[model samples]
Target: MSQPVIALFTDFGVSDPYVGQMHARLVAEAPQARIVDLHHYAPAFSPGPAGLLLEALVPHLTPGSVVVGVVDPGVGTARGSLALATDEHWFVGPDNGLFASVLEAREGRCFRLREPEGDGLSVSFHGRDLFGPAAAALARGDRMVLGEEVAEPVRAEARRDAVLYVDHYGNLMTGLVPPEDGGARLRVEGRNIPFARTFGEVGPGELFWYRNSLDRVEIAAREGSAAKRLGAGTGTAVAWIGGV
Candidate 1:
């Protein structure tokens, strides 16, 4: 079998030392594993939207890859650690609903992660000290190092009609999937945004909704920022105006 790929997904922006530290630990602990920086700028302190994005992106990842997801707002608190094994992927992170959408979208098994007994884990940086090691272990096929299996992981109530993320181009990625008919209009900020095939399909500065690469409903301007034009950001409300 080929070496497993370990992907990192977190809100730790690239400028910080947190992400680099996790990378160093993974490299040292699982030298044979391949590491991929899937994403770092997930919605800060908001795991529900991040989870929705993760659910959409997970299917596009390499098969059997281990994803280390960390969007924990309650890191130092009593929040439990989790290790999830889906049909095609493994996820290690806090149990504060960071992996909720992944579990909901697939058949998976959840385990409470077992922290290193005397590794001097830090309260504020579980992503580096705890999840990184667990992901490396899973990538190395050492499931025994994880804790006992759990019946189910914690699930959060995610808003399907909210903006999950905004890209650098100002495209607003909503949590909703495109309608099967492909004719539904999106209502946002009191404006009815129609669907377009792509940015070129709309006039310059005109706003339209389209199915993004991940198949999620996204609002974008032809050559401008839909987020700026609509005065919207992450967690903005979106509604489907047309019928099913």
Candidate 2:
């Protein structure tokens, strides 16, 4: 039998010990599952753009996988926790609209996470204390960690016209899909970027927009950093020639 896939997504950079603790906790909870580090740099303290980026990444995950996304700025607050089950995957995260864009566009059922047992949960680090274990349980097909069903977890206004993430290569991944017209241009940070099929189609250092692997409109500067060139990062507004 194949091992279940448990993917981790968070804002905790690899340089910190937070991500390591999450890995250890997951291993302790569900050792039989295969853990995958989906991403750790999720536009720190920004859950809206992070959630949108998570939604965009849904198509790339293995079917029946469990994803634990932690970009909570309200970790220690009165906010709730969530275990969301979609058709192809399960998502465990805080209820602070971290799963908003995913649940908003797709058909998903949300459940409140049960209070953590065995160990004392850290108020500020629910990723390792709560969500990580719940995700492990979900990956193992054990639903005991999930509590009551959430009628509606939380809702967020996703800006499809804004940058959702800036990858390490400095590519600007936006929430907006490319326009139907192939020749459309994307306006960003006071400059109009033309559309290109791919990096090879444009000259090095030239700024352009293209449909990324995840099918989102992305800004890039061949052989250069688009973010640096445009002085843009996550939440940077973008629009097509006719408008977003």
Candidate 3:
């Protein structure tokens, strides 16, 4: 039989034993399961970034994989653990509103869970006791349920109509749209803004926003950090007032 594949995504950096212990627990439960690390460096509790990375990596993972994502900032809160079933794979994690909207967007199947036989359910470390062993059991060909289906989750909206992610060079990377055949207009923080294809198009040292290769509006300075100037980062709301 083919070894079951389990993908681990967590904010637990390699500097600690938390991640390792989870792996050990999983292996102890399901010996034939193949464990793969999707990533261990998720920005602490920054599920938005974690979700974005998870979505981007989805295409590259093998089919029929069980992906365990534990970016739980509210670990011991009333938040519950979940197991999502998609046409291709299973995604398990805390349902403290982390990427639930994104998961629903992909038509995933969700299940609410309880502990399995011989599994100790610990609220403080569900990733190890709950997620790890459950994934292992599923890998061992055991049928299990983790959560129930629900309506789509609510998502954050861009204040204007775009967001900004800082680039390696510290560019604000806004979401303002470019001018059309006539002219393009955008809005930000309730104020209208103009678009520039290049930094030079804007006055020297002045801030401007424009669409880039990804087509999302980006905020940038003529030769500086629009982020530093605007005091914003990814998820900073901006609106595409008008563009063609």
Candidate 4:
């Protein structure tokens, strides 16, 4: 059998030791696995928007990969940890709606993670102490250790008309999918942004909307920051206009 690929998605930024510690644990636990740093700055502490971004990103991941997602705002409390087996990938994370869109789009089985038996599992750092190890185990094909299967996992309402993420270039990636026909426009913050094939199609610093590689409608400003130009950020409302 081919070795499983492990993808890490989290709100733990690169500057901190949290991500490094998770990487170290995965290395120790699942030495043979290939780890992919999918995203580290996933709209901090907000799983609903994070889940939408994950859903848009799912198509770009390697098939059969194991995704370790952590966007838990209620980590140390009574919230549960989960392991989800989708049709083509396995996702390990907190059951705080981070995997909601993934579950909604794919056929999957959800399991509550079994707590660590004797290890020093920290209350605040479950991403390193708990989820990372569980993801590694899943990547190594050890399903038995993930605890009882749950019938339903928590789900957040998928928002289709909201900006899910803002890229480094300040492009606003909305949850709404692009229209099938070409000439669609996006209305945001009282501005009607026209559609463009690419950046060059519009004048520099001009705001426009396009279908991103992920097939989501994205608002961008050619050679500029759309987020600033439109005064928008994550969770900002966007409306579609004039498309077939």
Which numbered prediction scores highest in lDDT against the true structure? 1
Q: TM-score for every candidate vs. truth?
A: 0.97, 0.95, 0.65, 0.96
Return whichever of 1 and 3 wins on TM-score.
Answer: 1
lDDT of each structure?
Answer: 0.89, 0.88, 0.68, 0.89
Candidate 2 error regions (>4 Å): none
Error of 3 at 65 (Å): 1.4
Candidate 3 lands at a TM-score of 0.65
Q: Mind giving the per-residue lDDT tens digits that candidate 2 earns over 1-244?
A: 2688888889998998988899898999999988889889887887788888888888898777899999998988999899998888899999978889888778989999997766678889999889988888887778899899999777665788998889889999999876676678878999999989999999989999999999889999999999999999989998777764
lDDT of 4 by residue, 193-225 (tens): 899989989998999999899998899999999
Q: Model 3, 1-244: lDDT tens per residue?
A: 3978999988898899998899889889888888998788664676655565466567777788888888888787876667777888887887655555347448776676666566466667888978887788777877655445545432322222435346655565443334445246655555565667777688876766666654545666777766666666666666555435
Predicted candidate 1 versus true structure: per-residue lDDT over 1-244, tens digit per residue? 3888999999999998998899899999899999899999998898888899999999789898999999999988998889988888999999988898988888888899888888569989998899999998888888876788888677776897999999999999988889887878889999999999888888999999999899999999999999999999999999988555
Query: Model 1 — TM-score against the truth?
Result: 0.97
Separate clash counts for every candidate: 0, 0, 23, 0
> lDDT for model 1, on a 0 to 1 scale?
0.89
Q: C-alpha displacement of 44 in model 3, angstroms?
A: 2.3
Cα RMSD, each candidate: 1.0, 1.5, 5.3, 1.3
Distance from true location, Cα of 1 in model 2, Å: 7.0
